[model samples]
Target: MKTCRFILSSGLMLFAAAGFSQSDSTGLPGDDFSLQGALALFKRSSSVEEFEKLLNTESSNVNNLDLNNDGQTDYVKVIDKFEGGVHAFILQVPVAENENQDIAVIELEKNGNESAHLQIIGDEDIYGEEVIVEPDGDDAGTAMMMPSSGARYDHGPAAWLTRANTIVVNVWTWPVVRFVYSPSYVVWVSPWHWTRRPVWWRPWRPVSWNVWRPRRAVYARHYVVVKQRRVVGARQVYRPMRSTSAIVRTRYSASVGRYRATRTSTTIQGKNGRKVKVTKTKVRRRR
Candidate 1:
């Protein structure tokens, strides 16, 4: 009886591990474009015009989306909007004769001469949520500090958790971010429309999900996804102009919606020798 029980428990553990591995690796249509890659490219660009050119280049590998279903990668354009020291660069692509879909937006705000915040937000229609990626590294120190009220904390992790609720990544030291905040800097907007694209730009066939999934590791190391928006004012200015491709939007929503519905819960023993209820979410797709 003891041997049989051990075998049953081991098999169940193996089954759960396999499920987790598959869920972690499974790629969705939205996974083709990497926001981390976009943020990294933006850091390297001197201006938004140069950024747009780099985004469309086949070798860049940042953009692998065919939103228009035209059998070629779509050309992404950059439009910079400035208001009250905030610079919001909108990344968009034309999918139809009159419709232009927004892929993402890079928002930057300069608080002082040497302090600034930056964040890149992926469109919900494309990413299935308001996916925001920002540069994070100083949070460990920032979280240890007290609140603006100068309150006292008895616990260290509690203090860390309190200040961590609101994280503002300062990217002023970043070369391109500093350039944008400089007095000599001018707003950059792509000259290319549906009729005009960069002469050097050549769209290529997008790679398979299996090939593209591993490429994210390059940019994933440098950035982190945060729940809060640091540049709210700049993002607010873009509210009226935000748009998404209907074709891609519908497909992404359907694929993501199905996955969200397949959640199940089970009780498992924790390291503390206590039972904890955990929910497992699995994706279901039609063959």
Candidate 2:
């Protein structure tokens, strides 16, 4: 009887291990998302008012990001750069202040295959050490520390208990971004740079990952659109460029996980080639 019990216990253990492995490795049916598809999903499901409210918050124990650099923390927003289809998801965390503070931005490709990179810009003395957490057990990710009071990473893993499918890091591109320094206009004491180039970015911590229905199946799909601008009169523009004014038709976004754009209209496109009419969000920049 003891021998039989031992065999059964071992089998059960093996089964549990198998289950965990499968659960960890296996992603959702459409885990890999396209930019156009994701934008559709976000628009169809997300509440515009709720998103605006989130962006206007002055302070919150959770998701408090000072994007503009004005002593106070401003709200966060997602800027959808639509070229032909979609370009990238810009996680814009603005700070509150008179002069424009250095914005915190994380640019990501909708369907990056595999690559990894982390660059934290600001004062090495003021901000101090970085927190590098490889959460998700086997799945890979990296985050550097920034100077923030709420849910900020100082010198440890910015552990995001996120579903494996919502965000992904390509090991091949482990550290795609290079420098972390201040740009021409600097405000906050901490190090930060709003990179025009595309890089990986996770949302502010303590977000409602399961804000959507069907709790377990939800991801960070809530977002409104913002326009992205760059210095014109440049050379060899690959992707589409965003106009500060006017919305354009849907062309779909291309994934440049570890790579590299040029411009288009403001109108957004929905599923099955349905054009979703949206007003242009006038972004104000102060110096």
Candidate 3:
């Protein structure tokens, strides 16, 4: 039963690859690359040589580095033969991280031609395991895992990462029913561990009025300064009073009670032509 399942899986992979090859030959250029194409190519070519020759038309040197510091070097690069034309990709893979041994290298090339080549270089580990992914169920867009993971998103064809005895899973569903879109990529890394998670999905909802309500009205105080000169009363004129002398011996004495008083009053006007009254109360004599 296990052998039959393996053979069935292998046959399905080959069929998918052949379908992609045909599509590449005939599909319109400058269109968004599909996940289906990536999966098909990923399945058909397991080594760098096979990937490059199968998907690309030319080859160039690619530098290798351990981006994750996993001790084993893993690298993938693409070179464009024409100044601005199709690109050829190459990738190198090692059997294991700790071992000094080398594993498979594959090459993929893209030219105007539709047919791709797949070539294998060096000895391959036949026992090496490959990750298998497929639709979760008979549902048109649903994706499921053979070993289930807890996380799920609304729009999906799900993805999973298995490492260090733990499987991290991410499932997403498309919001639009008819159109195909790109999936968001997320990465998580730890010492000795690394994985990717798909973007979180949420339904579109109308914005809440409470969230955008205007804040309480604020009032600020301001003052203005005005300059104006005020005019008082006009100048007043004073008249002198005469005193009567009293009859006596030798030097005549002046009688203080015999004097007559004269009074003066003035009127003042404001800027608006309003009249204001002014009174002179008393008179004084200087000796």
Q: Which candidate leads the pack in lDDT?
A: 1
Indicate which candidate wins on TM-score: 1
lDDT of 3 by residue, 29-62 (tens): 1011111222234344433334333332211111
**Over the stretch 185-285, how does candidate 1's per-residue lDDT look in tens digits?**
88887887788777788789887665665675577876778667867798677888787666666656766565556767899999889999986656432
lDDT of each: 0.71, 0.27, 0.24
In candidate 3, clashing pairs total 32
Off by over 4 Å in 3: 1-34, 57-287
Q: 85 in model 3: Cα distance from truth in Å? A: 33
User: Relative to the unseen true structure, what is the C-alpha lDDT of residue 219 in candidate 2, on a scale of 0 to 100?
Assistant: 24
TM-score of 2: 0.23
lDDT for predicted candidate 1 compared with the true structure:
0.71
Which model is ahead, 1 or 2, in terms of TM-score?
1
